[model samples]
Target: MLIPQYLFDAEAFLAFRIIEEKFHVISKSRISLLKLQLLHERALHRGHLKVAQQACDELGALASPVTGVDADLKTEVSLRHARTLLAANQFSQKSGNAALGLPYALASILFCQSFNLDLLKASATLTLAELWLSHGPSEAERALALLHGVFPMILGHGGLELCARAHITEAKCHLSDPSYSVHHKPDLVLSPLKEACEQLELLEYHELAAEAFYLMAMVYDKLGNLEEREKAAASFKEHTLALRNPQESVDDILNMI
Candidate 1:
């Protein structure tokens, strides 16, 4: 039940939070207050680190005093902090960053789940799996391991555009995976892709909806389902033209058929 309009408010709030995170807080007498300041600073430092171990430490810093945060800020920072961890995880996944991405990504996943932010949680879980997968075929085996954890979240959230996008993001992971299977693999992606398409249609996300059908068509092609592929291709064209002009006539889209 995440309303799209709330995003406008969220954007504004995220901006304000950035300012709050950046505005220097003078160290004070209270030990509890000092810990909170340390937590905030370390959370922000997540983006500054290139190594994974350092990022992990940064995550620890945030986690240690997370309880000290006011309830309201807890909700606000939970999502934002998760996003920052993912960012740092991506940046540090290679080189000296070591397993830094693992902790950051894991923390992000936990924070999202703790708050019942299903769409965000799903995205975070998929991202964590992807980080493990990037190590190659052996690691990719774990990519879908935690996907089930997020599925219920997605179902509960229903049909928001963000929910759809989250599903599409994870589905793409399976689609692009090198080790999914020698065959019968693209079939694995169809359900999530279809779910994404349905959600996008509900939200009137014309451009993205078109892309979803195009992705579905590609999956059908991979599965060697000629009839379904053709039908999907037809829908892809329809959605594409819908973006060009929402009221475009079927005859115009049919001309290429």
Candidate 2:
């Protein structure tokens, strides 16, 4: 069973506040690592990573701990550390640091999945796919292999379409260069994404479905099908409008979008 939301939110918030306050004051490597590890856990729960690198820097300062922690706890700590490394690697790649994010990204995937946290597992896989397509195509093949394994997990959690579509969008960004043959048949990937969005719509996951439709528009735009693009855009508009004012009519939503 899922943990109670209120308790989870309360604990996460307290952890976040404590870590933010301690980040500057704690100088000991071991202490910093412990605090940052907790901070990373909270941030993951909230799906925000604005301070992920700073948290990772703290994690990197410590010597690896001796192997006394429970195996599950050890896995959790390792995965959190790997996520920090992945964040650092991505930042470095973006800021013209040497392209070395793939190893850390791959490690993050391996470790995060050790605990069966589906969101983190899917995220790591998706990030690896993106890193492969952008900074390393040979690595991208390895990432695809990893993705094949993780894809079923993502599907079980109803994230397969969203994850696939996001990867396709990232691939397009890198593949736009004629020299790169990164484009896939959108129908194959995008169909699942669309299905996922429809499912979300049925479940009243309006905000998520809105995001999905926005992504679909990106795919349609890339395919140069203006009609499909328009349709996706309309869906995005409708969903987002509904989210903003659930009582609004479809016509009103369309007008707002």
Candidate 3:
């Protein structure tokens, strides 16, 4: 069945249903990988963890036979699988299993290293750092070190959205740093967050931008900057509403400001 790309980009429920109905037929073809990847990304973007997981599982199955597949293809699959695993783990709140994502992350990192895929290596590194970040402040040190190492790669070779993600991760690392509270330094966190929001807004990554704005509001509140906090909070609300109502016009969202 030839499915239109826009069908996969349609409303989440409809997309999920269409994909599920055609999955068995589609999985037999060479285009399956691309289709599954697109589904995984769209599902993840729409916060449909189960649908993403379904796509990831099929991707994992396709990549299971390691003998004849192209090295780069395998590595890309590994990275996406790791990302999906991490997202699922985060959404499930499977307590005491914080390291549930560790092996998948390590596999992706190792695949990147072995294949000498530098840009992908940087992404895999970021995923590892994110996993470490979830382990708390003690692990934030390790995560920060990795984030620092990848920033150059992400900024120099990665796309704008990836660069924005790196900035957001860096800000999160700082926020999670115990020293941040002790030193009462909001600027270190705020600067990167501001940059991240700019990039995210430019890309129209509304949900992620909403998250960045929410963080900014918290940071401003901590620093006793009520005016800035109010602005950030307003932006957060605007972006959040935009995310919920994806059909909302840019002018409508801007009018909320």
Which digits, one per residue and each the tens of the lDDT, describe model 1 over residues 1-257? 54432243334445545555585473222333333333333323222322322333333444346564543334334434444454454444444232444665566566655676666666666556656654555554466566556667666764465566556656766765675651565656788788888777665556557767888888777778889989889988876675566342333222211
Compose the digit string of candidate 3's lDDT tens values, residues 18-59. 675787565544456666776766666655666667777777
Q: Is candidate 1 or candidate 2 better by TM-score?
A: 2
Model 3 Cα displacement at 8 (Å)?
Answer: 11
**Top TM-score prediction, candidate number:** 3
Worst 10 residues of 3 by lDDT: 248-257
- Write down the lDDT of every candidate, Cα atoms only: 0.54, 0.53, 0.73
lDDT of 2 by residue, 71-148 (tens): 344444444444544444443335422235556555656666665666666765665555555554445555556556
Residue pairs with backbone overlap in model 3: none
Model 1 gets an lDDT of 0.54
Q: Between the candidate structures 1 and 3, which one is better when assessed by TM-score?
A: 3
